[model samples]
Target: MSDTGGLFDGVLAAGPVAESVCDGAWVQAMLDFEAALAWASAAAGVIPEAAAVDIEKRCRAEYYDIAALGAAAVRIGNPAGPLVRELTASVAPEAAAYVHLGATSQDVLDTAAMLVTARALIALRAGLHACADRLAQLAEEHAGTVQAGRSLLQQAPPVTFGLTVAGWLGGVVAALDRIDVLRGERLAVQFGGAVGTLAALGDNGIPVLRGIAFRLGLAEPVLPWHTERSRIAEIAGALGQASGAVAKIARDITLLAQTELGEVFEQGPPGSGGSSTMPHKRNPVAAVLAAGSAAQAPGLVATLLSAAAHEHQRAAGSWHAEWRPLTELLRSTGSAVEWLCIALDRLRVDPARMRANLEASGGLLLAEQVAIGLVAAAQGAVGRQEATDLVAACCLRAGPDDLAELLAADEVIGKYLDRSRIDELLDPTGYLGSTAAFIQRAVQDWRSRSAGYR
Candidate 1:
């Protein structure tokens, strides 16, 4: 019946977003816990060597204040207040003196959240890089792998599987780049007291604040951020963007794997699906989940944007609403990354299917190639319009059988090229331009940049 109990209950039942935030609690806890240790160690010197050791042990100890912490959070409409009260209470009175010393509620909360965000970002960056690498590998492995490239749910032209993979890789690489940039940007901390000043800590405020940041592995900001919510918004936005990228890839995969277009399929044993009536159906469950999670990211980002509109010094509504939703976005995004990685890793590529599909449209897909050939043969004798007209006429008049016969018999074309040569040019495999080369470039670039972290 208590407010905290209700809060805990709500958080417990939350979807992926809540789970991410919940799992992230440990990282946040570690930051705050260390802050207390540093503060205690710096102040009163009341924290002895043995007690320091004890504090470390106790801080490392696994404990949950879900109910109490949740209740406190509701009372103050924020987690920081409840978290400080509970943690301070848990420490021995001697060690407790150092707990939260010279630091306001926002100090521990924001920095701790940043620590968690940093870790999450690191993990996410790695996941995106991995996805990019997988895509590159797939592109490399199937560089000349031909398939029908579809547009508007209909076959359009001959395209290599490598080219398709490369496109996906491009998106992943871009997302990775964004993540890298975000990591380097200074994530400001919330250090100010009740207002926007370090008045609580008096003259010792700056030093003590720096000490807390140093001990907790966080960046020190010039001032407290009771009102400036940009960093938080930026972090949320980054996460949302990354999730959206992953979702787009998932959506593409799901579409490509549709039974009607079966050019590719999920690699593993099909996970369970709906009704007993549709016994043969094996849905694209992982892809769907990834896509759905991705679809939710934009809304989360919007919420973060809304949160950024805090009133001059503080705005409770905008700030408080950010905690849970942002947490959920982080969690869902992480899950989506994990799922996408698995899906990409085990993807089933069908070069033959690609080839067959490409060929299904007859040699019409090679209309462009024919036009080029005509232009070359004409040697400026015919304009582009004339060449295109000739090629179009040839394509429409010739079926697969006829096209093969004509290519063999026509002196102007056949004398210069053979059946195999024409097939090679018309084939998606040979026409993939620089797909393989691009994949290699991406792989090298990503590996070089991600070397330290990987």
Candidate 2:
């Protein structure tokens, strides 16, 4: 069944990760583990090959009743117990003995969780790379497009829009790298039997572990991690970092698309961003949803972290607490990534508006440049403090008047610089320090690192 119909699901959980963590997907992952375990047990000489083949045939998820399993899970504290029981009943009596041979409920469930996570990451990773590629394109396209750089919500100086997008790209690449490492090295199979030891499997336990890892395509853990939950915490932390990165870009887009700012907007077809009450409003809905989705991640990550304090050999409530939060965290961050892709895809920039807004400050944004120019023109006749004081006096007196014109008309300041020199210093584009180089570096880094993304 499709995971649809919720009011905010389309916006908050709209992606392949949503499907990958659904009930059916979880059931299938568990069944896949059961099938793989049977095959692996047979390979380790722990179960007959014919019995393993029979058990595998009955391990298909479609043969099980998910609703019944959910209800039965309450009795045994996990769905794996009910699932194994049903699988055993479905197979012949000879194969039934080997259905879940030497495996505990946590073994199947933990491995299943990893399988589900791996599948979900396949989509999340793709979406992130897509977002990174779009940012790279934006950075290259707007490398020379100058805009005001704001600090603490006020205009500071000139910076290219390309540089702004490049900053976003850098964060995304970092997040992607963290997630890549976790997916490759940490998502391992959990195979120890009850109490963290494969006592039932004895000498064949390691072979069975290797076989399961090979069949399921997951990393082989050195031992069972019934109580050790660092992998889950690591996944949560990486996803939290990714959500933060996506939220940062979304926040920037929303801010730039503000009514007063209007420097950038999410372009779309008619009726895309219409307001229910205000007809003229063109909202950045995608960015807003992306930010909203990301906003829910920290709390979910916290839940996972809290749940990571599992008791020895197994957890009472902590392990169970991780199930929903972990899946929801995946869903929320995945939604953020998907929404960000849509936002960047539809993003339209107004270079003219950016330039106009930069100039709206009336040269105040370039005050630092002006101060530096004065210090140079003084040629050490005036101390640095004196030049700074003079510029500060000019800025205060120049309110509503052009700063360059005000500086030019100042008697004390006019000795070192003229209107021509002042205007040149106030030029926004001329004051962009290393903006192009930064953009190039960001794009180059993305291109090089992304080449190795699998």
Candidate 3:
């Protein structure tokens, strides 16, 4: 079966990055390397300049039959052989002699892979930046909007929604930084001729390599890394981390958008987040799709990591294994980030519902704060453990009676505390310790980091 045009393609592999890694793009990238090689060889006096121009003119991917190239590639175990042969045949005889000079099939394909990766990364970075910007806006706008903080799937204390959004922003910024570093420093050209040595091109090899690097806007490595797959593995790992970050944010949205909670809703266009059978269901479809797309990344990353163990100077099957997994990884990761951006942009918050939920536990959520307050108010009259036990007992009776009223009526607690004092202790707004500060710090850090990204 074919890999493209699935029912879920628009949901799982949607974005410009998908196009950048398609079969046509791969063929074009290989042709680009061949054209660059010819021009670089001519610049280094290794081939005629006229031959370079002739070869360059024939290097357009639109001129070649991509399906026929794939069919021919099966015989040679790679598409580079068929591509180079076709490219050579398409050009004049002198240009054909100069096509893919002093470069192995591996060199052409590997370099083409780098080209494809660099372009796809550009699209991924844009999606990440869009998500980061939306998160920053939500963080700043809701910096003071208090909500119940849950731990282990149960309500615990209070935290601002801004702080939660800030947390998401921090993760996106971190992933963006890693991707930036990889794009700037690690995308090196792969040109080692045959077996990691440019023995065929003699002394002209280094110059041609430099020329190719300059022409393609890729880094010039000290040596070709035929067997070293760290660059590919690193790319996989970074995209994996990015996908994880997107999943975390999306999962939070799905949880918060639950029907029972009702604290947040995804305000997308009509017909989105719909259920066919269940008309009342307004599912968090964007977040669900984002999470599903991200869920596919870890296994793809593992596949790339498994292929890292190449034998000797060149891999037999290991190198061949990286092609499809890496492409899918890039596409899936890009789709996840894009969906997350859409989810956050459409998110609607309910402060009233958040406050109502915060008060749902009848002051049991503030048991810890009340205990600490009792200890301080008692002023050594009651020990810390005594105060803790007193508060725990009061919490047990909180649903039948208000925890504040229960604590104020307790014999041991009533001596040092009044109803007003207990009320203040149980106030979620008063108990959001360091929340605003943390939100500020998170927003500042994101702004500082995103400034460079912009």
Candidate 4:
């Protein structure tokens, strides 16, 4: 049999981050069941008001034997089989028949999964927004906090910690916007019985489906999606892309916090990652977890792509293969978002180290600035190539201290600008064009969009 362990397990092991996704699945399943019952009762006109009230009460208070559920699941080689049995046992005998009327196992399971995905996406958006907020705060706090910008593992030039944080915030904001776009798409449901057509439910099937969706707070689809799994595939793809953003941030943080760099550090207690042999090591464990979880999402997404290839109206094997992997993707992605949020919140930056690193580059970092200044001063007198050559020759020949002294003494260059003005222009803080402003705009936009729901 295929691996059918609960997606909750992977998320729980990571942290409370997966709680929203895990609990949402069970809650969504119950809600779908309620919606189906209510719709069926209204259409049949045989369901009494009192019976509907009792069914609602029982549905909300109902408990399941999870161990038995698991055993049954293994026996039948299906997750919905056990869930259906458990839900059936929870209601009164008279109302039990109407509980899942005209619904196949896929109807309940697929709808429930979509609900879980929606809730998870909401939680992930919140996580990304919170991280963006914190990053903006850090950027503001360290706007003038200059440090060495590295390329190819070598110090290059001066850059502010604020600017780096702003870059991260930009990526996160983009991901959040993508999530908002996806939330509006219709969450397709599987309602067709035995095949793509609703033969089992007779003529009134389409109307019943609309009623069911209305009751469940879902959009109605034109037809059942027994074979059309593109929506699911798309959601998984979006999730993987979001996870990639988190991973990129984690990788950058991990590199920045390296001992040799010493420009930034993780702010949590040092005991998070214990060394088996070495006593002085305090590893960036959260970063490592985020990277690993983010790395796994793409493969899970690929699995979804494979599952989308159904044979005719239904391929039980291919369809079932989607269940566990999709859940795992949700859980892992949720965990990555949570971890990155916390990591960004507690990060510590050292401006002094940044300056030292910049100086270590032997004045090479300011080559571009110097070239620009020369170009401006010469205007039509010097060509771009001559300006670059002059700056490069100056940078290559001068030591860290000698470069500063030489630049200060140069009469032609100093005539157009003083040392103070040059330093200010080259400062990383002055170079951050509109990072904080962009972050504020994103936050406001998100708030306006979410106002109605809140």
Q: 3 or 4: which has the higher TM-score?
A: 3
RMSD of each: 4.8, 1.6, 1.8, 4.4
The CA-based lDDT of model 3 is what? 0.90
Candidate 2, 304-414: lDDT as tens digits: 998888878888999889889888999999999999999999999999999999988788888788888888888888777887888888888776557888898887778
Candidate number achieving the greatest TM-score relative to the actual structure: 2
Q: How many residue pairs clash (N, CA or C atoms closer than 3 angstroms) in each of the candidate models, in the order given?
A: 4, 0, 0, 1
Each model's lDDT comes to 0.66, 0.90, 0.90, 0.69
Model 2 residue 384 lDDT score: 76
Q: Candidate 3 regions off by >4 Å? A: 1-4, 380-386
Instruction: Record all residue pairs in model 2 with backbone atoms less than 3 Å apart, i.e. clashing.
Output: none
Kindly give the stretch of ten consecutive residues in candidate 4 with the minimal lDDT sum: 445-454
TM-score, ranked from best to worst: 2, 3, 4, 1
lDDT of 4 by residue, 90-131 (tens): 667876676665666777677777767777777777777777
Model 4 TM-score? Answer: 0.83
lDDT of 1 by residue, 189-210 (tens): 5566677676755676666666
Model with the higher TM-score, candidate 2 or 3: 2
